[model samples]
Target: MPSVQIKICGLTTREALDAAIAARADYCGFVFYPPSPRTLTPVAARDLADRAGARIGKVGLFVDPDDALLAQGVEAGSLDAIQLHGRETPARAAEVRARFGLPVWKAIPVTAAADIERAAEYREAADLILFDARTPKGALPGGMGLKFDWSLLAGYDSPIPWGLAGGLTPHNVCEAIRATRAPLVDTSSGVESAPGEKDIGKIAAFCAAVRSA
Candidate 1:
């Protein structure tokens, strides 16, 4: 299976960021969307990102943000990459990557096999693809810890560097990796004690689970 990369997403506190780096996470993600409980202001994210330094890649998660927010994330958050978790078109993803000069990761909400097939639309435009569980109508985009069928991705040929995301926890992450042979795994609410609360022990355990898988 080679080595699996892990991203601890929606980190809002310095403690969580420190925990992620201490646990050897491959990427540390910050949410920029205001509707989320884990949302962080650009200045706060920048402080944490700077503190993290180059030890872990810093990723900013956005849900169809305008250019103003992107500017703040770029100039302040010091993000290494941008994650678009919205209804962004392939062309919109490409444009963001070109204009921002940062790697663009497009999140595809999967509810069925046909949903996974839609990844091909961003094959050429996005630098990476993330498959997350599709939430109920009127729900927030992601970070809900809602999991899709892991088997939906079994033996699937992903168009770009890709990952399996929704509802991953330390208890079941290994099964997810084995089921889909995921190259990367991302988690937000799964390791939390409560909404926006990152548990250090859970963070460490989740990373360990990925390595063991």
Candidate 2:
């Protein structure tokens, strides 16, 4: 089996970032969404980003962000990619990519096979499409520890590069990979001890699980 890529998202502390790096994660994500418990200010993000410095790919996660928000987040985080976890149209995704000149990942909430098919809409607009579980009304877009049916992606042909997210814990991540054959897997709450709290042990375990799979 091909090696799977791992992204540990919603990192809010130096210790957490260090744990992710030490565990050999390919990507480290910083949340820019205000309402999420994992949210970080540009200044705070900058500290973590500066410390990260080429050790791992830094990603900035945002909701339906405007250009100004994106600009601040990208500049401060020195983000390698922008992950949009909101209701952005394909045009907006393309616009973000053009304006920022960075790889753009649009998160699609999956509830059914049709949701997987919707990824085609972002083929031209985004650098990658992330399939995550759909949250309930008024809940956070992701990092909810909720997962969709992985079988929905079985034998599914993606129009562009893609990744998997939502509700993945170290215990189940191996099975998740086997079910979807996903090239990349992302997690946030799965490695946390509580809301917005990153557990170093969990982070290591999750990465090891992905590699073992």
Best by TM-score: 2
Model 2 Cα lDDT, one tens digit per residue, 1-213: 679999999999999999999999999999999999999998999999999999999999999999999999999999999999999999999999999999999999999988999999999999999999999999999999999999999987888989999999999999999999999999999999999999999999999999999
Worst 10-residue lDDT window, candidate 1: 70-79
Writing each residue's lDDT as its tens digit, candidate 1 over 80-186 gives 99999999999999999999999999999999999999999999899999999999888989988899999999998876899999999999999999999999999
Count clashes in each candidate, considering only residues at least 3 apart in sequence or on different chains.
0, 0
CA RMSD of each candidate after superposition:
0.7, 0.6
Q: Give the residue spans of candidate 2 off by over 4 A.
A: none
TM-score of each model, in listed order: 0.98, 0.99
lDDT of candidate 1?
A: 0.93
Candidate 1, which segments miss by more than 4 Å at Cα?
Answer: none
